[model samples]
Target: MQLLQKFKLGKSKKSPSKGHANYAYTTARVRAMKSKILPKETYPRLMNMSIDEITRFIGESEYKEDIDELARIHDGVDLIEHALNRNLAVTFTKLLSISEGDVNFLVGEKLKKYDIWNIKTLLRGKYCNASTEEILEAIVAAGRLSYSFLSSLAAKGTYEEVISELANTEYYPILKGYDGTNLSDIENQLDKMYYAGLFGTIRESKSKDRKLFAEFIRMGIDLKNLVTLFRLKKSGIADPEMMNLMIDGGLRLKHRDIEKMMPLSFADFVSELESNPYWDVMADVVRPDMVSLIDIETRLKKHRLKSAASFSHVYPISIVPIMDYMLSKQNEISNLRIIVRGKAANLDDDIIKEQLVI
Candidate 1:
């Protein structure tokens, strides 16, 4: 597999840093917090429970406070959805609060994706004339941008007004190009900017942990690109058009390699992936004629979390554990939402089981 072969090709060039960040305190705190995450065995029990039962289950667990706080105004899946978002936001914000120096900076950098996500949500909500309440429901203030700030943006009367509000920020440069019909384009650019900025942040870091984190980031990019390729290929999108959608700087699949794979037929694409490192994790689920990419996507997500946890053990005192905890916490939230929402939608237990990472 050229993908695996290329993994041995070279490493990212790095520059030295004189700044200091002792992560022992942060890592310890994160580990303690991670222990509170719902155990894997809990999902099976949740699967058998009614929506109310599941709600009550989480209500008595880590999410109890969130449920209690929101129970007055929301119930059922709506309560779960809002509580999940709030809990996630509080969880992530707590991460920033507990860390200092480079640790805080790195955590903040990773969390910026939520900021980008909120911006995209605001733009999307405004683009579709979605009500402010509807837009705010989608916001997860997990980034440096506060929930109140995002809520205010969502309440903006126009996309242009939202853009005007963001003018002083780094995203304004790209947001200015939004001409009403280019929401997708704007969203794509914002997404690209995030990876670009994140890669740049770690590119010159002298810390071994940051370098390892870079590897983890690249692995995520590779999986994201693969999902994008799979989705576009399944949709019969032309190969040339696929390049524009592909993000740069994957760990195994470089830009050039993705370029080469772009022109291949869907079957050929699947064949090419057989040589990729991720193929082992996804091989059983991937096929040229697969009906949906959801299974493959879900498998990759599980793999990513597994990989993060595995790496954390090798560098217990470093950012790896912190990142692992972050991923685990997010996974816990996602699993809870899936169970509650799936039950509300009358989805089968087996289907919900397939979606849960644990």
Candidate 2:
């Protein structure tokens, strides 16, 4: 993957915090954020907490502002979910504010997932007849799409109006022809479009520093593809039906590979994730119990976050650290939501703990 010799852009591609990039400064900030991230050791202590205790605990963490802002109107899991999403949005928005050049481009590319997320939120909200306020809370304004645009789209009365709102964007072309009633179909198109755009951006880049960034996307796509593949297989879905859900362009897992594997069984893929038979290095974090799908998904995500942090070190000056920090912060928000929701539902501590990626 070393393209330094093959492609030279005649610019200081390795610029850190000094001169061209604020890399040194950004890395320092990212390191500090990483350090302040909820310690893995603290998850056990958190699992023992009740709803009120968990809310209080969250108030004391980095999410205090988000909590205070939303606590006045929302309560319990709702309060926590909105607050967590807000804080996650703020965190990623801050990443973009502080970054520039390749770092900015790479982070922006990765954050496009939120763009897709916001679109899905719009679709689901419209389908369920949810309020604009509710959908607004779910929108993370970290991607190129402005908060104003999303807010406007969220306020639209119908999904057709929403799609019309996005007529000028990349999502327009794919979403325009879809039957608006089938949210599942639209969501699949959005996912494929998002990944296709991301892969295209990285592949088009001539910078060597961006190589690892591409690798990161490949890893993510691979994980997502596997998770979706297994879910479909376990449900006894026919091979012919998975084409839309299956994402293309993975590191080792391709569309053709998926086509060949789907008609067989899920056991082989389960074992791969369970024991890391193929990718031995990822075994430690993604050791799924095979009983619970949540466990498998959690394992995959936890490993993905862990690997992001580790890989950041390998290219500290590049986009790695900033992007890694973004994922870690996102994981923090997800963990908090899981805890809040689990506790509010009166689920046991151990059950809540099982869902924690920390």
Write one digit per residue (lDDT tens) for candidate 2, span 57-153: 9899888998999999999788888778787878887887887755676677778888888888888888889999988977877677778989999
User: Over the stretch 34-96, how does candidate 1's per-residue lDDT look in tens digits?
Assistant: 999988888888888888888898899888999999999998899989999999999999999
lDDT of each: 0.86, 0.76
- Which window of 10 residues has the lowest lDDT sum in candidate 2? 12-21
Candidate 2 backbone collisions, by pair: 17-24
- Model 2 TM-score (2 dp): 0.86
In candidate 1, list every pair of residues with a backbone clash.
none
